[model samples]
Target: MDIHALKRQGMTISEIARRTGHDRKTVRRYLNGDRVPGVRKRAEPDPFDAFVDYVTARLNEDPHLWVVTLLDELEPLGYAGSYQSLTRQIRLRGLRPACTACAHVTQRPNAIIEHPPGEETQFDWLELPDAPTGWGFPTKRAYLLVGSLAHSGVWRGVLSPSMDVPHLLAAMTTLLALLGGVTRVWRFDRMATVLNPVTRDLTPMFAGFAKHHGVQPVVCRPRSGNRKGVVEKNNHTAAQRWWRALPDGLTLEQAQASVDAFARRQDERPRRTETGNTTAKAMFAAERLRPLPPVVFPVVVAEERTATRQALIDWRGNRYSVPPELAAAKVVVQQRLGADTIDIATTSGTVVARHRVVEPGLGVTIRDTGHVAALEAIAMASAPPGRPHRRKERIPPGPAALRAAQVLTGTGQPVSTVISLAAYEQAAKNRNTLR
Candidate 1:
C-alpha cells in the first residue's frame, strides 16, 4: 500500500488506493508491490525421477546389491544421471537400500489354521559353514534342525551333520520324542532328502521320515522361501541370536551347546509375532501334536563292516582296536560324529571302548599283550629317588698325559698282558684309578 511501492509496481498511488479501497496517504505509506504475499516459488524438477522408482524396486528385490552395481544397471536403462544425484534421490525418499521385496500377496483369510495344543508344527534345516568344535580337535560344520509349533512357537532345534534323510529323520524323531508326540502336520521345504526328489508334476513327501511320525508333510513351493516364511525368518533370527551370539573364540560344540540353550530360551520367551504370548503356554494349549507310540527308533546310525584279524578298525582312518571278542568276526559300526563321544562296539552292541574321538589322529590300539612292563618302567623313572648318591670325586686324566703314558708304555703282545700291567698299577695305588 506504500506510494513508493505502488509507483514502482507501475500503479499510481491513487490507483492502488482505489483498488485496495484505502486512502491515498495509507496506500503511499505501505505500498511495496515488489513482493507478493502467501506464495512461494517452486523448485526445479527432480533429475532422476525417471529411474528412481526402478532403482528402488531393484534394491527391494535384491537387498544384497551394491549402489554402484545398481547405478550400472540404471545407466543402461536411459538413466542420464550421476551417482550423486541417484544417491540423493534415494536418501530424499527415505529408502532402505537393502530391503527385500515383500510379496504383496496378503495371507488368505484362513491360510493359517490354529490347531489345538500339539496339533501341528513346522520343521526345517539351516546350513552353516565349517567351524571349530569346542569339545574335540576336528572342525565340525553342522546343520541346524529347527521345529516350531504353528500356533505356539514352542520349538526345538538340534544340530546334525547334514540334511541326509537318515540324519534328518533321526533329528526329527529325536526332537518329536523329546516333545512327546507327533503333530498332525509338519511343514517344510522340498529338500531332496525329505522330499523324494519331486519333479515338476510329481509331489513326494519323504516316505520313510513321514511314516515314522504319521504326520502329513506339507511342502512349500520350490524357490519360494516366502511360502515357508515363518521358519525362514526364524532361521535368520537363529543365525543372528544363535550363530552370531556365540563367543568369538568358542569351538563348534561350545557354539552348538550355546545355540541350543539360546533356542530353548527363545522358545520359552513370549513371541512378539504373537502379541507377547509365550510359545510354551500356547503350545501347551494346542493338543494337536499327537503322542508318539511306545516304540522308539535308534539314533545311532549303523553301518556294517568286516574286521580282518590284522586289519585295525580304521574309522575315518583313525584305528580302534576292538577286543579279540570280535577279532575276525564282522561287526556293526555305529559311528556318530557330533552328538556323543566315539564308541567302539562289538557285533552284539557291547561297548569295547568309550573313548572320545579327540584329534583326527588318536589311535585306540587295544593290544592283547598288556603294556604293564612299559608302564612300570615309566612309573619307576617318575618315582621319587630313594636316597642321594655318595661317590668319591676323582680328577679325570688330561688328554696330553694319557697320550704320553700310552706312547711311553709299549704295546703289549696280547690284551691279557696289557690288562695285567694296568692291574699292577691299580694294585700299587690301592685304588682303581685307571678303572
Candidate 2:
C-alpha cells in the first residue's frame, strides 16, 4: 500500500522510495508486485490434464459408467490424481454426455420425515445392469433386495435370481434376518409383486407374510421415493460404492458375504441424530426391533428351466443333470421353504431329480449316476453296428428299380447303358498314323 499506492498516484519510484525512506529497488520491487494478494494462480499444472483425452474417450464410450470405474482405469495410466479431482475435471469439461431419454430431473418441496426407533423399515429393489454373464444367471439384470432401518440408517442387501413374488419374499426374509430383526411397519414403493400398484392394497400372499411376521405394510405414494429417503440414499451408496467395483469370478455366496461386510462396516460411520453425532451401530443397538418369526414364511421359490441337449438344466449358475429323455424339454425347478435340496420336477408335479444346493456361480456341474447310466444305455441301444455309409458315394439305379420305374410309367421301353470303344480305337489309330 505504501510504495505501490504512492506510485499508482502518479509518483515515481524514486519519489516514493525517498518519501517512504526506502531504497529505489525496494520501491520498484513493490511496484513490480512480486507478492500480490487475491490473485488466483495455479502453482503447478494439473496432472489430470495429461489424461483428459483418455478420460473423455472413456466417457463417450459409457456415459453412465461409474466414476470409480474411471478411476480404476486411470490409475495405471500414469494418472496420479485423486478421484475427486478426476470427477471435478470431468464435470468442468463436460466429458460425459447427457442422457436425454432419462431426464427425470424435477424440483419439488422436500421435508425431512423423521423415523422413530423401532417404528419402520424401508425396502426397495436395486436392479443392477451388466451383471456377470458367466454366472449363468437367468437374466442380464441382477436384483438386490435392500432393507434399511429408518432410524439408524443400518441396511442390508440380498442378491436374488429374479423379482418374482416368491423370490422377493425369500430375499426379504433373508434381509430381515441379516438386519437382526423386523420393524413394526414395512414400507414399500408399490412393487407389483408385493401389492397392487393402483389400489395400493397388499397382495394376499404378502399380507399373509406380514401377518406371519407381525409387521404392518405401508405403501408410499406414487413416485414419492423420497418418502423412504434413508433406504433411497442407501441404494445409491450401495450401487455406486460397492456394486460398481465387484470383483470378477466371485461366487454368489462370496458376493453376498462381501456386501454384508460392506454394510456392517458402514454402520461405524458417524451419523447425526436427535441428541448429537453418533454412530449407526450405537443407535441401532438402542432400536427396539421385534424378534423374527419362529420359521420363515412358506414362500416356495419355483422357476421353469429348459434342459439342454446334454440333459442338463441351469439353476442359479449350477448345472444339474436331468434324465436324458428330458433333454430339449421344459422342466420345473422348485425349492421348498427350509429345504437343503432343489427339486427338478415335471409339468405334472412329479419330482424327477434332486440335487443338494451349492454355492451359486461357481460353474459346478452336478450329475446323477443314474441319469448318466440311463443316457449311456439308450445311446448304446441305438448305436449302429457298422461304419456309416459314405456321404458322397454314387448309387446308380439297378434292374429292380428300373423295372419298377417302367411299371409305374406304363411303358416297356428298354433303357440302354454302354461305353463305346470305337472312339478310343479310332483315336489310337490316328495317333499311330501321326507317329
Model 2 CA lDDT for position 232: 90
Each candidate's TM vs. the true structure? 0.51, 0.62
Q: Candidates' lDDT values, in order?
A: 0.62, 0.86
Stretches off by above 4 angstroms in model 2 are 1-109, 316-319, 347-350, 356-366, 382-435
Q: Candidate 2 residues 1-435, lDDT tens each?
A: 766677779988778877999888766765787655455557998667789898878877778889999999888888787888888998888889976544553444566787889999999999988788755567888888899999999999999878988998889988999988999999989889888776777888999999999999998877777789889999999999999999888867778889999999999989986679999999999889999989878878988887998899987678999999999898999997777799999988899999998876677999999999999988888889986789998889999998989978979667669998999999999999999
Candidate 2's TM-score reads 0.62
Tell me how many clashing residue pairs each candidate has.
Answer: 21, 0
- Candidate 1 residue 57 Cα shift, in angstroms, is 13
lDDT by residue (tens digit), candidate 1, 265-347 = 76566554455544555555645656785654435655445565653455433555555445566765575524445566676
